[model samples]
Target: MKYFYYLLFALLLCGCQETKKEKISRLVNEWENKEILFPKNSFFTIFAKDTIAFDTVDCDYKVFTYIDSTGCTSCKLQLLKWKGVIAKFDSLTHNNTAFLFYFHPKSAKEIAYILKRDNFNYPVCIDDADSINKLNQFSDEMMFQTFLLDKENKVLAIGNPVHNPKIEKLYLKLAMGESYTDKPILSQTKISVDKEMINLGTFDWQKKQQVAFTIRNEGDQLLVINGVTTSCGCVSTEYNHEPVQKGKNLKIQVSYKADHAEHFDKTITIYCNVPSSPVKLRIKGDARK
Candidate 1:
């Protein structure tokens, strides 16, 4: 009778251990795969121990915490200073604007605590445990991946973080309304233009007309206009000088010769620093005899 009781007790203990292990495994799995969304239409910032800092239009800074494990001890969490811009992108929260951050056990613990403490009210993501473990093995190195998506979750910009300095500049560019590409850093500067769009009314195709466009350097730094080009040979442009200084204006005289004129439309692209992307000017009119 005593032997039967002992066997039953052993079975119960074994079953309890198995159940406990399974429960722990499930929790860990969920933590690894958890996906939390930021507060919709809300703005928040993210800071890191490394480079990168984000501020909203109001210029509010973000705070973060870090965790480190010592030997066989539990993790320890410490608050970090505000570093870079990891803010919410109001209407720009499409997949293209979303950024992913991979963290290790220590970093993950700190991140998890932040997520829970903040009620998961921001646009940040925590990596899975498998990725965390891999990062742990490669502690001396850092890696990151950024994806830019359109409204339908289509990726527009895909950048792999390797070097620190290069990534820092890339983040700044994205923050300032530029899309990421595999191309090198072409230019960075400031410029002043009368308007983003130009409208030239109707003109006789048999006559020639000249219009003046001004380019200024409103920024604190020097502005460089490398060159200008038009779609057709009928149009020509001349600049004031090579490099335009701050607070100075360069006159771009555009002369259009009304030869073989019908409904005329042309686009001119000015490659410069103020607007790092591209500047387009339009000229349109009806050619009358």
Candidate 2:
């Protein structure tokens, strides 16, 4: 009917009106300074192999992360990445910050295997009953699930710094007792990419495929690329770390290695000193024999 179509149009328009910046602002406002509750009766383990007692240490800050069993366990946990982050923090703060990880897994065996495979030696709470998530009712978005907490477990910021460079800077600044600013102070510029979406068509699932994207600086100022982050471990990106001068082009090489035979859609985010700093590109296709 005409009325039904009009209703759908309004809904789509409203959805399009909400920008990523606005959404992040709203989420941060809702969670900032909120206290997080941790259930007492939870199982703890080290490297997912040895039984351990959960001990609370008095630290200046705590980075708490909760992973629920829904998607690929290895991908969601990203234990290897966590290992690096933990090392970095320890070097800087010297036990001033604690990393608390809780995972509610569908299969305890899979979780254990992933932990060991990644060689993650940190203590983790394997909540098979999902008690932590139930008690906290954490947000469904992955970005909002991780929290940078104060000594009392009050949220200082909500985001995974490992996945986002901007959030990492913010977390480090706040944790170190330094003044913080959410906005970047550098001059803003613009970028132009050859393509935002790359369709690989169909390829052998077991083999790796590579694609390159050309990004050119369209602004007068130098464009500094902070980092490039992927949605999954199966995908990786390579780019020059040096700043790209105006009117120059930079090549980004993205590689995808499928672990299973299925349709896949992965995201690659580029962080730069530009107005739209975090530009996202997609690679999607079917993997077959």
Candidate 3:
């Protein structure tokens, strides 16, 4: 009887423990269609340069991103990359999308310098006390802190489009309306990589390691690579931007530099015109001192 009771307790514990996928599903259900509140009394600026007025146009959609005073500020902000994304979005949507950035800075001077250095002139809010995050109770993960909100400030989607190509596509589709299609019909190419995962084994932390992956075009259509993104600042990638002909292969060079001696697992995402628009590749290894 005692053994049966112990077994039942163990089974109950296993059932109570949620998997990563289940947790993500719960978070999505919680935030979906939820209205986001903005602090009306908060001040706005063009990156500390000048005071700016906040306006919500009736037909406009908003992309709100928040950065807390954790980790590398400049890396998390990526203001230069954001500048290009905003420019493209404005050009395509005819300035119908509003990008609202709220930062909880560890140092005001550092934030100011980053804005100036990146030449980011977009309007931003400095939530010194983290008022925005406090109200929203946003996810701790940086990737989930950004959201796409409709005219009514209700969340249409959650996730950073810049980091995830699928999220980017979803944002464009939601904002551009039903009839809008960005990719060409001939761009529906099929692609396959030589290896989806690579193990670098043990290496010195200070030493840089590089590896290449071969991507073959398996479809009749031309394979156009839109972009390649890395999960960490320490990891970088290089690849040809030109289209890949059918039955041809493109080499993607990935380099990793460890910030400290530790075990690391990082991902590289390839954004292309294939049915699976964003293909993910992972690299893992132990870094020794």
User: TM-score: which candidate is best?
Assistant: 2
Ranking by TM-score: 2, 3, 1
TM-score of each: 0.35, 0.86, 0.70
- Stretches of model 3 off by over 4 angstroms after superposition: 1-18, 179-226, 232-238, 253-267, 272-289
Q: What lDDT tens digits, residue by residue, belong to model 2 across residues 1-289?
A: 2222222221222123457546655666677678999987866788666888766566889999998888876667766667777788877777688888999888988777777766788899988788888888887878778988888888877778768776676667667777764445678888899999999999899989899999999999888888787887778888888889999999999999876787888888887777565788999999898
For candidate 1, list the clashing residue pairs, or say none. Answer: 52-84, 53-83, 53-84, 53-85, 54-84, 54-85, 95-149, 96-148, 96-149, 191-274
Where does candidate 1 have its weakest 10-residue lDDT segment? 73-82
- lDDT string for model 1 (1-289, tens) is 2222222221232224676645434433332312222223222234222233432224211111112232211111111101112332323333223333433344545455554443433433233343333432322211212322233333222222211223333434454456544333444667767765455667677688788788777777667764565544456677765777778888888877754556777666575655443466767677667
All models: lDDT?
A: 0.42, 0.77, 0.77
Distance (Å) between predicted and true CA of 26, model 1? Answer: 43
lDDT of 3 at 148: 80
For residues 1-289, what per-residue lDDT tens digits would candidate 3 score against the true structure? 1222222221222123457446555666677779898887778888676888877575579999999999777657867567867887888877888998999999998888878867788989988989988888888868668888889989877777667655666676677764333334554889889999999999999999999999999999999887787776567788888899999999999999875788888888787777665688999999999
